[model samples]
Target: MAVRILHTADWHIGQTINGWDRTFEHAFFFKELKEIVVREAVDAVLISGDVFDNQNPSAEGMRMLFHALADLRRARPHLTTVMTAGNHDPAGRLEAPGILLEEIGVSAVGMILQKDGGLDLSRHLVPLKNAEGVIEAYCLALPFPRASDLPTLTGESAKEAGSPIVRAVADLYQRAVSGAREQIGDAPLVAMGHLHVSGGDESEASERRILIGGEHAVPATVFDESLAYVALGHLHKPQRVGRDTVRYSGSPFPLSVSELNYKHGVDIIELDGDSYSYERHALTRPVPFYRLKGKDGLLVAEVEGALEALELDADLPVEQQPFVHVDLRRQTSALGLRAEVDQILSRYPVRDTGVSIVSAKEEGQAAPSEIVSLKKLEEIKPLDLFYTAFEKEHGEGPEARHLELFHSVLAEID
Candidate 1:
């Protein structure tokens, strides 16, 4: 019998989108995720990492995780699950309930605990049991490796190591894999990790750098052919690294405005004896991310026109409203662009996540565009921004009357 396993990661629970709590979106995704598990008759579920958005997650976030696990256990008592911690999680805290959660068919590995002066390989080994209580496979669960968790090396063997961090990481994996092989018998061993692989694409705005300069990403070679599959996390984009067997199951929902174009989903691995096949199932994003744009640099008139033309469902629930980001071309000024975008978006049933200004076309100065989020709008001076806006709109210098009118408005507001 082929055992089905669901591979997922980067939950980023308790994450907020521009200060808006996304509990509704998460709840919606979980509802669909649970359905997928039950419908697929999944025998095991592997959550690679990023269980929480931050190290000190809110109590509500804690409830969300516990409830999701308890609900899954109730739905499928025979199901097996293994979850690890990411950089965003407090590893030790996640492992606090491990002893109690193990009885409920869930194994949570927060960190690679060192015991008795040697690495504790006991907690890392998890037997993947299929429905009807048959051991079909084994999972070597590894979490986000802290610098402190990595083994130190010295002597001639250490001299050949290209980078200390990379060498330590590779050795840790080899040790864990070697230990898992000792007990898996005829079962094909699978592994899970919450770190960046050499070739995996990253969402710059959402994913945090695992290493200081991101110079020590583990290579795919570290995962040898002995493992049937390797479920990875950290990177938000779903992709195969080195081979199809090594993959990342991206986050279920978009975590940042930069992820607007990303297709978020989960992966399913069908394990049969020693061989397995993989498939990706895209999840339905409950709250859609809609890009609101204008032709070329948004001319003063065109920007307002685009906002009025934007169609949004008036009766839509606030919690289910789509996220909006305005793509404005950089001209000479940002004086009223952000304010206008904010004012117009407020009338529609949508959440304004960000306003991105594209770099202006200037001869010989070839420069990269700066994405100015609304959060940083306060740093800009009002008059300076208005002057830039004035020049961009009219294609000429601002008149003294324009400045006088601007000050008059400011005085009126004051």
Candidate 2:
């Protein structure tokens, strides 16, 4: 039996803390998802992890996701939706009221699997039989690995071996996959997990700090032959791990400008019997926001040229204007920068971007003396300046002393 599925992950709902509005992007993401399901005639949809930005999403965000899921269920009654919880989710929120998800025809594998010690692996072995009685495939839902859950790795002093965290995580994943295999029977299993795995090409979104010998990531080799394909999460860039069998289906929206160049989309996997092949579906973003670094005159002209030229591409819409990241390198005061950007923002009517003033000093200029003046203050980093000003405004006790030390260290010409 052929198993046609939509592979997607990292919805990251309620992720509006950054400069961009995630709500808008996610709204479009689901719309595109809906279109994909209808166009592809999908059998099931697999969301690897990070469904919600945080456990407690805003009421509006919840409503938006709920409505989208509801629409999917209504459109495709036979389509099974499989999802798992990522590190961002609160375990309790996904675990409670599990029955409600069944009614909606969305099989969420998050907190459900982790409840009552571990997953009832047997339940997943049963192949998903369609309306035509054709057995599609088996889905093994594993929640985000936690050190406390793996009984085999029990030891308070495990860290003495050096890189204890990496060993412990590997052990947990091995055990989990082993248990999943027993229940897998003869069905082609697709394991949906929410931990960082090795072998993918790292882009801007892939810029994250993984601890040394810690739970930074797991290798795709862990999945091995047991899983025909491993749908992964945590990293926001779509990439292949190991033998292309394991893949991280990156976030739908450009969360940061770092991800501006990444092709955000879903995977359309076509399964023939036990073997499968897949292709990427490119998503359409509203605007192409970019960071242009140059002098003042050059920066303004480039933005203007881009704005005027963008309209020629019929696929690109006016509202989808490129958000400008103005990095002007010139000798300008903070007040002057504020005024310049403000003028541009008003004239261009660009509501979705920002600017940064990076002053460029000529080489071999004499460095300033110890007594820091208001004019020299502009040379210091914005973060340093803010903290120093904060200390000056509010009498320094503990935090002020720390800020002063930071300011002094930063001011030194290294």
Candidate 3:
């Protein structure tokens, strides 16, 4: 019998974009995921990690997570789900309702614990069984292990020159793999990890760095050849580690502008007998993310043209409007740039679309002037300070109109 599984990770629920809530996007993603699960007739679901954006997620975020899971279970009563906690999640919080969740065939492993002062190997290991109650695969459900998760080591192993965190993580995986092999003997082993793997490409803009105890990544070779597949998380780009068998499913949505260009999706794996095959399933986003830049022209005019060129369906929902980042060339002053951009955008029907302005000037350019002496806070007037800063940046003090505006503001304060 073939065992089909949907592989996904880094849900990062409660995540926001530019201070705007993204709850609608997450809801749409879950709706699509449910459709995929039903269409594929998947027997199991493997969610790698980063289930929440932070350790303390909001109530709405928690509600969405539970509702999504409940909907999935209702759609497929025979489905089995295995989820592990990522660095962003509070392990204890995620695993608090473990006993209750298990009643619905869902298993969550937050952190590996010591039983009787010894590492409990069984906690990280789970057997994936079919509806007929037959064990088809053995899964090493390893969560993001902190310094306290691993067992204490002595002798030369503890005194290794490299990072102690790396050594401890490797040791934990080694023990888990050994225990799983001993229990199942080789029934297409699968391992789930929420750590950064060496050689895996990362979406730096979106993924949070998972450095702990001075250790950032683990070598891909640590997975071993015995495992049929190594499902990984932490990175926000779907990619292979050292080999195709070991892969990251990435985040379901474009979490940042860096991830906007690539196709976002999940992996569908079919494990039959001793062989396993997988395919990527692309997801359709409710709103497209775009980075817009002006060509060689006046900043205001360039912004106006770019916004005008975009063909958006105003009839669509607000969440369906495109989110854009506008880049403009250097100007004499950026005083009214945001207002100008907003004014141009308002002409279009995409009022709900978010727009951010960025200066195209190269960073780290030398200032036009240098300060000769530092003045004490009480010694310098507010207007004097503003003029000095403006001269240092623009090679000149405030213009007559700017000085007039400043004087009027002072008059109002008086």
lDDT of 1 by residue, 1-414 (tens): 778899999998998877677999889888888999998889999999999886666789999998898788878899888999987776877999887888878999988877776557678888887887888888998898876687767888678847777777888888887767766655788889888889888886677456422443878988868889999989998899999899989888888877878888899999989678888888998887876655444654565566566666788888888887778776578887777777777877788787877664564575655555555555354655775687678765443345446756765775
What residue runs in model 3 are displaced by over 4 Å at the alpha carbon? 116-118, 152-155, 294-298, 334-339, 346-414
Residue-wise lDDT of candidate 3 within 171-215, one digit each (tens)?
A: 777877877677778688889999899987878445534645435
Better of 1 and 2 by TM-score: 1
Error of 1 at 101 (Å): 1.7
Q: List, in order, the clash count of every candidate structure.
A: 3, 0, 0
Every model's TM-score: 0.86, 0.74, 0.81
**Best first by TM-score, ranked:** 1, 3, 2
TM-score of 2: 0.74
Backbone-clash count (model 2): 0
TM-score of 1: 0.86
- In terms of lDDT, the best-performing candidate is 1
Which residue pairs collide in model 2, if any?
A: none
